[model samples]
Each structure stands twice: as C-alpha cells, then as structure tokens.
Target: MEPKHKRRVRYKGTHPKKYNEKYKELNPELYPETIEKVIKKGSTPVGMHLSIMVDEILEFLNIQEGQIGLDCTLGYGGHTLKMLECLNHTGHMYALDIDPIESVKTKERLLNKGYGEDILTIKNCNFKDIDLVSNEAGLFDFVLADLGVSSMQIDNPERGFSYKKEGPLDLRLNPQKGIPAFIKLQELNKNQLEQLFIENSDEPYAKEIAKNIDSYLKSGQLISTTTQLYKIIEKSLSFIPIKERKES
Candidate 1:
C-alpha cells in the first residue's frame, strides 16, 4: 500500500501569529497568490525577502555584462539574483554572508535557477573578511553591500532575533559560533545590563529593566525564551501608559 498523505497544516484563525506556522508564506514559489496578497497588504511574506531598492541599486552600480560583481551580504539571494541578471549569466558574481544556514540554502536555490559554478559563488564568510574573497576573485568591477538584519533573520522565531515571537533566546548571526542570548543574559550583572541597554539600544528605562531582570535571576528563575524577556521588560515599564509603553 502507498504511504498515507498528510494534510497541510491548519492555523486556528485567519492570521498566523507564529513565524513557523506561516506555511504558505514560507513557500512563496508554490503559493504565488498568497505571496502577492501579503505583498499587496504592505507586509512581506514570512521566509521571503523582497530585494529593497532594486532599481536604485542597479542604477548606482551600473553593472554591465561580463563584469565581476561582489555582493557583500547575500541574505536571501534576492539582490544576488538581480546582480547575476545584470551580468546576464556571462560574468561571475561572488556573494558572502555570515549566516552559514541561509547561505547554503541560497546557493542551492540559485543553482536550481541555473546559476552554477560558472556564474555564482557564495561563501559563508563575513563581509569584514572581504580581503580574503578579493585575494581569490581579484578586484570587482562593482560591489553591492546592502547592510542590515535580513527580514528572514528577524522574522524567524527559531533564529531568536525578534521578541515578537516566543523562541529560544539565541541571537547570533551565525548560530554555530557564539553563546546564545540566554547564556549572555545570565552572565551579565544588573549594572552591566543597564549599560548594555543604554549603549546598545539607547533604552531610556535601562536601569528599571535591568533591575527587574536581575531580580528574576536572584529568585532563581532563568529567562530562557524571547517572550520571557519581553514580559520582564513590560513589567519593568508597567508604570508607563499603554500607548507610550507599547512603543517601548
């Protein structure tokens, strides 16, 4: 007998609050209509990254056929794909990203689209080490570096980049390299936490937030998830009105 076919995952309501639960948005190719609808509503689909300022970037670079191009940050390969198109499959493009997981997935995705070894090369390396890449590939005719946290990184709950969803408190760009945020949080003292809040994000209620987090730790409660930390922040600023606190 043939193996049983599983039904598609069903969400409780019209909207999916969890990032992983967004099955349609995750698979954009298989559900173009849903993707289009999400885009039309001025929201990017989960697990899909729309290249920003595509025309503006192309205009500035003025990439030509048979020219070498370097993409310093290949998040979802959207910009890389466009740059490859500008090369018209004649020249080669080299892309680098710190995210080993996403970069490998993107390499396979581009290969499927016919951008093989001859046309595209992707490496799981930081842009800070561009000299290494340049040493191998030589000088680039044009370079594109769209810097910022990728939406894929921010939106994925498992990546732990955002507090909007509950997930493991791991926030490293390369999850393999460093200790997780949860570990880091446990290590820092109250004063260090306050300084970190101010120095890192310019948070005004740094002292209060840090104090509360310290309190939880002193009580032997480990803050393990994004939501757990988010609640601690909320409680710290509970005195602020709803409107102002919401912005925080």
Candidate 2:
C-alpha cells in the first residue's frame, strides 16, 4: 500500500491573507465599519423615562459588542435604546410586546433612530412566545424580562391601568388579546378573585377583598373603573401598611 501523504497543518503565519481577512468580513462593525454613527445617533422616544435601576441592570448584564439581546417588555424602548448603544451593528436586539400600539410606536422610534436597517427586530407578541422568536433568531446573549405593566401604560389614563384615573376598566395591556379587567372581574367568583390577589399582589387581605368583590357583584353594583376598584379596596382594608396599601 502506498504511504499516505502527511496532512498540512495550517498555522497563523502559514494561512493565506484571505483566511485572516475573513475575521474582518465576519465583524465589519467592530473592525472597519463605524459603530460611532450608530451610538452617536441613538434616540429615545418622546417623553421616555428610564427606570432608576437602569444602570444596575446594565452592570448586571455586562453588555458587550457583537452580542444579541431581547427586551421582552419593550415599554418605551428606554432599555432597548440603551442596549442598542452597547451592541455592535452586527448585534441584534429583539424588542417584543403584545400591544400593537406600542409596537408601532417603537417601530417609528427605531426607524427615526436609523435602526430600521436590521439592528433591531420588533415583534408584537407575549413573553411566552419569546423562546420561539429567539429560536428563530438564534439564542440571545442577554434577555431582559421587565414583567408587569410599564410606567407609560400605567400613567396613561386611556390604558386603564391606574387607579387614579376613571377610565374604562380595561387593564389588558393588549386590549385585543385578553378580556378586560372589568370583564375578568365579572367572570371571576370570590374564590378566584382571592386567588388572583394572593398570587399577583401577595395581599394578605385577599380573602376579604374577594368577599367585598362578591358583595358588590351580588348587590348589582358593577364596578367598571379602576377608581371604583380602588375605593372598594381602600374601604375594605383599614390597617394596611404603607407598602401594602400602595399595592392595594
């Protein structure tokens, strides 16, 4: 049998210039393309305010270039914009929200900020569907799940998330996706209400709150506004602590 020729081992010096050039081709944003344009032109939505803990969030995540991230709850895109500043042009940021309205707002903001090219992908979907979205986009380097309603949604009276406002009791972040808060209250029994309060708010007076809800339902006193609910909750519980009272 003829002896097999030795396979040539490729060393850094032995490699062709094309082989070294491939690295630059793979990461043009880092090597050749200017990332300053992307960072310098970063924009925030009108009236956008970041959370107090944004710096802490960034520190914990330790965002780096060429890293993909997901803002699971793209409230006003404050965190999203910050992450965009940290990411390379090659890095992708996926901002997901169930509300079509917010999605539209975010899209407009991103377009104005010059992220319309491909750095960001906005999806109108729930957090549960993020895995599917990420799977399609490959895994993310960082994933931010800012659960619950955003300050903007809560501050906006039309959304009906604030007890201070007397808007329609429509607390479904995405009004088209789930039943409104009023409808949900109408459907829920006392036990269900208690369970929801306990699970979500961790209120100790959940049972009492549920009893009050039952009483209101039985008396035909349909409470269809956040203000009405707030009054009911306030009246039901008297000695709640400040922290607990705020939640109530």
Candidate 3:
C-alpha cells in the first residue's frame, strides 16, 4: 500500500439549524409551524379565474428564458405571472385587458411584487387592435390570446354577466368600451336579433325568438335586464318545454 493517508480535518460552518434554534429561543411567540410554512412558500402566489389551457399554450408558444410574452386577455395576470416564472431575468411580460378597473388592480399587484420595467408592461386596451398594443412593446416571441369572458366577470355581481345575478344589464367586458347589454337589446332589429341568436346563443328557434322580441317591443315591454329578457324568451316560447329546447 502507498503511504497511509494522513487523517484530514473537516470544518463545518455555523448551520441554519443552529441559527433557527437560537432565533426560536429568543422569540418564544413565533410559531415554528408557521415559520416553516413561510420559509417553504417564499411569497404569496397570485390567483386567477381563467380557463387558460396553460399546457396547450406553453406547448404552442415554446416559452424559454429571456423570451417576450404577451397575454392579450390578462385576466387577473395568471398567464402573465406563470410566464414570468419561466422567463429569465431579462425576459418581460406585456399584459393587456379591456377592463380599466381590472387592469388597475393587476398593475398594482404586479408592481407591488417588485416587478418594474424589467419584468412587466400592463395595458388597459382591447386586444382586437393588436397594432396599437404591439407598438409599445414591439413583436413578442409568444402571444396568448384567451378569447371570451373570464370567471371574475361572471362571478362579480356588479358586472352583470350572470343571469342569476341581480345587477345592471351591463355585459360589456369593458364597461366604458362597448354598448351596455340593455342598450344593445334596444338597437337590435328583427334581422339583427335573429343573427345574434344564431351567432351567440345558437337558439334553435332563432326566427321565433326574433319575432317574439319584435312583438314584445311593439307591446312597449322592451327587455332591459337579463331577467326581463329571460322572462320574455320563456313567455314567447311557453308552448315548448325548456328541457326539450336545443342547447346553445
């Protein structure tokens, strides 16, 4: 055997375990379980109520570090935050929403978390006109356009997206942008009503619905609320059972 190796000494630094023990000893009020959870969780995570097929989105986009991502409908910033997590420090997110109130809330929350110019760009504008928005941030490597409404609009009673909710007849994604639902109802002609039924609700008796709506307006009982419109539809087609009617 070669010369016997001399015994080597290993030195260990003062460990986190020792520091934690000392900290607990000094602060008896601290709950160990809570502290452990905090250490594990790091910071509070943001929540979202979108039907974003995240897996599909990522698969199509092929997100990578330092890539730029645009969330056309950044409802509550769910996709934005998720993309940020995957992006490198140099990467950025441009989140857009038509709703001013919702946009403001999302901006404040993102800014509060130390995400500044390097991390995020929030815009309160419609996604349909992509040129106006893209001019600010230029072309993005990944663009996520989640078409249609979000759960928050439906859940929030004030937004009036839900028929069950007793609120104003305002179904606009951006209250300031589009005609209010009630006002839109007033503007619909028989042909327009028939078209709306076919496109949006896919009503089986689209022609019948349009005729009934015209008749109801003629009676001076124009629908102004979801409840009112629902009642009109029910009464107009009372001859048919609701269950047997074609689904939208």
Candidate 4:
C-alpha cells in the first residue's frame, strides 16, 4: 500500500465507560415514574427494596432536623435513606445490619450519594446488642426496628432465607454468628421442632412436619437445602386433602 493509514484516537472522557457509577444518582428524572410503576405492580425492582409503610414510619418518628436516630434493620438502606432525607443531612443516623455484605454495599452507596460518616454511620452487628452499641454511639432520639428478613435477603438464594428457592438451609440472620438452619434442625428433637414451629410460625401441621423432619434426620438423609425441607413438609401434609385444609 502506497498511502499510510491513520489510526483513530479515542477520548476516554468523551466516551462513556461500560459501567457508569453515577448513573443512578445523576439520572433522577428517570426514577420517579419507574418507582411509581414498581409500586403499582406491587413488585420491587431487582436489587432494590421498597420501603414498607414509609409515610407511617416517618410520621410516627417525626424526625426533625439535627435529631439523631437509629434504624435497627438497615437491609437495603431504604428506610435509612428516607430518614436521612428527613434529617436534611444535619442529623446523624446509626444503621445496623447483621448482613455484613449488604451493610458495606449500602454504606458505600450512601457515601456516593453525598452522605458521609457525619450523616450516616452503619454498624455490622445484631440489634439484640443495641444496648451496648447505642451506649457507645450515645443516646438516640428515635429508634426504628423492622424485625424481619428483608426482600434483598430473601431474593438472594445464596443467603438461603427463602423456602421457595432451592438453596442451602442457612437461615441465621447473622451467618457469621450462629449455626446454620440445617444444623439447628438436626440438633432439635421432634418435640422441640414441633414446639419451635408452633411458637415461631403457628404452623397447623407443625407436629406432623416435625415428625417427618426428625425421621429424615435420623435416617441419615441430611435436610441441607430449602427444597429438601419443603418436600418433607409437603409429604407430612400430603394425607390432608386440599378441600379439608383450613387456613391458619
């Protein structure tokens, strides 16, 4: 070839990267309608949790500017975010989550949204130890504890919280602290299992389900997954006809 070919130069700043970190915050107009759609559909967007009863919570708390508060279950930081907005970046929020993975991610996300430690402080600890943690952080004006497994935790099969999902039977709120659900199941006797189910969930078929699960454990068939436990429960109740089944 007689003519020399010229190489095209690419500008890094002009060309958008494959992953844009600021897209979520920078594009505010896109989310209002999207969130409304999610609310109407009664489904949370993937990787996001819709704060339950937010208006009620905010009203009850009546968080004023420069007031300190504690959010005991900071699963997806939805409640924390709302509380922070109410505080108007002047007050401090102590957020607690047993899930370390989620806590870190939420902390970083909030920080990216212009909230620093001065505004939001996250603790990777159980709310059961709130007395001790709160003492160190000083007194709080308002405390909100939403005690339940969050949507994010249940949605992720790897965390092993959902009965519908086929995942490990690890239901410990703090995976790092206590024994997994499978081990706990193996340790409990039929009576203990029945009592647990009755007290915790008020399952009508608790006794039968407990007996089946205990038998399975005794037979050396490890009930280590959600589906396995689900099958055991199903088999235990299979004798009852669908027509005869009463809602608990």
Candidate 5:
C-alpha cells in the first residue's frame, strides 16, 4: 500500500509566522530553499540547527584521521557531523548534551545520515562530567564545546525557552531535571528579584518588573505560562512614554 499524503497546516497570514506553523522551517530537510531563507536572517532552522563557525574551528583544529575528539555539546549534531567527516571514518567522536529529549532524536538523525555508533557516541549528561567520560573513553585529541542554548530549544514553544511563545515559563536547560522558571519567580522577593534581573540579564526595568512580580506572587496570583510573564513585563514597562519607548 502507498503512504498517505498529509496536507500543510493553515494559518491566519499568507506566510506562517508561528514557530509551529512554519512547515518549511519545521521540516527543512524537505524544503531545501528554506535553508538560505533562514540563514539570511542569521537564525537556525526550527526543529534543527546549522552549526556556526564550522570552518574556523575545523581549520584551527586541523583534525586528521585516527584521532579521537570530544564534542561537549551535541546540540543538533551539526558541528559533530562535520568534525566526524574530518576523522574520515577512521576515528571516533563522543558528544554530550543535557537535553535527553532532543539528544535521542539527534542521535537517530545522525545515524540515518550514515554516522553510526562505530564512529559517533552520544552521552546524555552535563559536560562537567568530563572526568567521568575521560575515565571511560580516554583523553581526547581535541574538544569542542559550544556554550549556549540550542536553537531547537529556543524555537520549540513547548520548551518555553522564549518568552514570545505561549507555553509554560519553563526556562530550564533540562526540563526533566530542574524546577520550572515560574516556581523560581514565585520564590523570589522583590529585592532579590531586582538583583537577579540586574546581575543576570542587566534588565533595565529590573526594579519595576521585580516590584510587580513580587506583588503578584504575594497576592497569590499565578504566573505559570510564558505569555503571563510577558504580560507582566509589558505592564511593568508601560510607564515609559510612548515616544520614549519608540526612541529607545
């Protein structure tokens, strides 16, 4: 029997604006043109990643066949794929990622692309466990650690990495391992919240945002979703003059 064809999802606008609705971005392998479309905007494709600075890193490393390497952050496995090619199938590449959900998908994707377990090994753990990895795999000839949140995480609304989305305010690198961001917000007092915003993000409206959040939490109001937190931030900053808001 033949496979059934699925129709594209409909949206309000001509082009899909919602992350989930962007069929091209959400399925880039099936839409090659979307590659340049996203790259021009300096954004990774949704549902996947295009590793940055590949040439620079490869040139600097000058990897050779038969040499072992470690990719401390697998992400969507883009960088690891390129590095594995430089090994020319003669050596091994080990990678780590904290996100169990995405990492398993990534391992499968890489395998489908002809990089099997013989050449690539993926571990689900924090990179700080390098000591443990080294004890098992021996010292690496070279290492690559991309220290940042993956685009897959940012674009997936369910992960709640972006405040623009309508998901829960999770804000966790590993959703299964940590308390959600909403809980943390509930725990912070106004002054502590102010300092957290200032020290962590340098948010200019730290004082105002913190004051409002503290009041809301104290009043027993809930803020469980990304949209709720975003509204609070907007309400806190509404005191700015419209002209001033546009100017700055």
Candidate 6:
C-alpha cells in the first residue's frame, strides 16, 4: 500500500480586514448588512454601531406619526432611522452625538436614504448639552437617550476604550474635548482614585489598586495605554488565588 501524502488545503479569495474603510467603500450595499450579521452573532463591527432592543424601545416610546422626537445618543442613526420611519415624513427627529466622525457619516447615510432635514436633523454635540439643542429645535414628544458608550466607540482602538486592544488610554466620549483617561489618572491622587473605584465601579480592591497606581504615576512609570493599565490591574490581582479570584 502506498503511504498517503498530506495535502494542504487553502481557502480562496482575500478576507476583508475588519474596519477597513476601503472594504466599506467597495461594498457599500453589503456593509450595513454585514454589520447586522456581526451584531446578531453577538459581536460588533469595528466602526458600526448597533441599536440595542430596538423593538422594545419603539414600543416603550409608543411613537406616533407626526410626533416630534429626540435621539440624544445617535451613535450610527439606527434608532433615529427607526424613529423617522415611525414618524412617516410628518414629524422631525433631532439626533445628537458627541462623535464628530460617526455623526457626520450617519447624517450623510440617513440623507442618502431619502430622510431630509424636513424629517431629520443631526447635531454635533454631547447629550449633556441637550437643553441648548432642544430649546433651539423646539420641544419633542418623545426622547431617547442611550446613556452607555456604543459598541462602535469601544471597538475602535483609536478611540481607546478597550483594554483588549492596544491603543491610547483615552476613555473620553469625545476625543476632541477634555483630557484622556491616562492624563486624568495621573492627575488623581490616591484618595480620589480609591473613591472613584469605590463609588463608580464598586471594586473591592480599590484602595490597593489606587495606591499602586499612585506610586506608578509618581515614579514616572506612566500608564499611557489601555494595555499598560490592564497589566497593572492584572498584577494587582495576581496575589489572589485563581479559585478565589472570581468571587473577588
């Protein structure tokens, strides 16, 4: 009997790089659908924002035709688009976002889909400034504010929100405004850091972590990236046994 030879199997066609602008531009029609698929599979596309619990949100809002609405965190216009559909050309939707890049793109996308200023208006501002925009645009019958950071923001490494990705330590919702989280960490004293972790995160090891972080900052070992900070956190928790770590 002849010895069987190992055969190498290769897949054809180049796989598109995740979040590649060229891929999105080349496959304009397929891009949005691809984003939906990714979201359904429990993962988010790098630059695409998925609206969560859309049906629930719409049902809860009890949107009616000709009723004005406001979408405070218009991440990628997913919610805004649905609201506009419900409005059915009779009402206007004012969408606000702090992300200049995504906001402009979403506005253009919505406009391309035939939603004009008569029915849709996009504003480049934080929801915290909603009072100003609302006053200018007039009152709204329904308002939606997605308070948490969108998946798009967290997935984009350049925005620096994920510890898994290697990026700057920035955690600001608006990169153009305010100092990044790394700088903020440096500015905070041990007490402030401890208090932040305790109040904001309810971390059990807040005091220990804050002390370590303060020492590192004072010693010029700057935690400038998410990975660096993540490492510090891992190291801080290393003393705990693996079995007990979960409860901690």
Candidate ranking (TM-score, best to worst): 1, 5, 6, 4, 2, 3
Assess candidate 2 and give its lDDT.
0.75
Candidate 6: TM-score? 0.83
* Per-model lDDT: 0.89, 0.75, 0.71, 0.81, 0.88, 0.82
| Candidate 2 local lDDT, 83-128, one digit each (tens) | 8888857688998899886668667776777777489988889898
TM-score comparison, 2 vs 6, better candidate:
6
Using lDDT, give the best candidate's number. Answer: 1
Each prediction's TM-score against the native? 0.89, 0.72, 0.72, 0.81, 0.86, 0.83
Can you tell me which runs of candidate 3 are displaced by over 4 Å? 1-51, 246-248
Order candidates by lDDT, high to low: 1, 5, 6, 4, 2, 3
Q: Clash number for every model?
A: 0, 0, 0, 0, 0, 0
Clash total of candidate 1: 0
User: Cα lDDT for residue 71, model 4?
Assistant: 94
User: Model 1 over residues 1-248: C-alpha lDDT tens digits?
Assistant: 99999987788989876766777656665788888898999998878788899999999999999999999999889999988988998989999999998888788888888899889988889999999999999999999888877887887889888887788989889998989999999999999999999999999999999999999998999998999999998899999999976675
Best by TM-score: 1
lDDT tens string, model 4, 204-223? 88899999999999998999
Which pairs, if any, clash in model 4?
none
CA error at residue 88 for candidate 3, angstroms: 3.8
| Model 2 misplacement above 4 A | 1-47, 239-248
Candidate 2: C-alpha RMSD after superposition = 19.9
Error of 3 at 149 (Å): 0.6
Cα lDDT tens digits, model 6, 103-189, are 877888889888988888888888889889878978889999987777667767777889866889988877788999999998899
Residue 179 shift from truth in candidate 6, angstroms: 1.0
| Candidate 6 colliding pairs | none
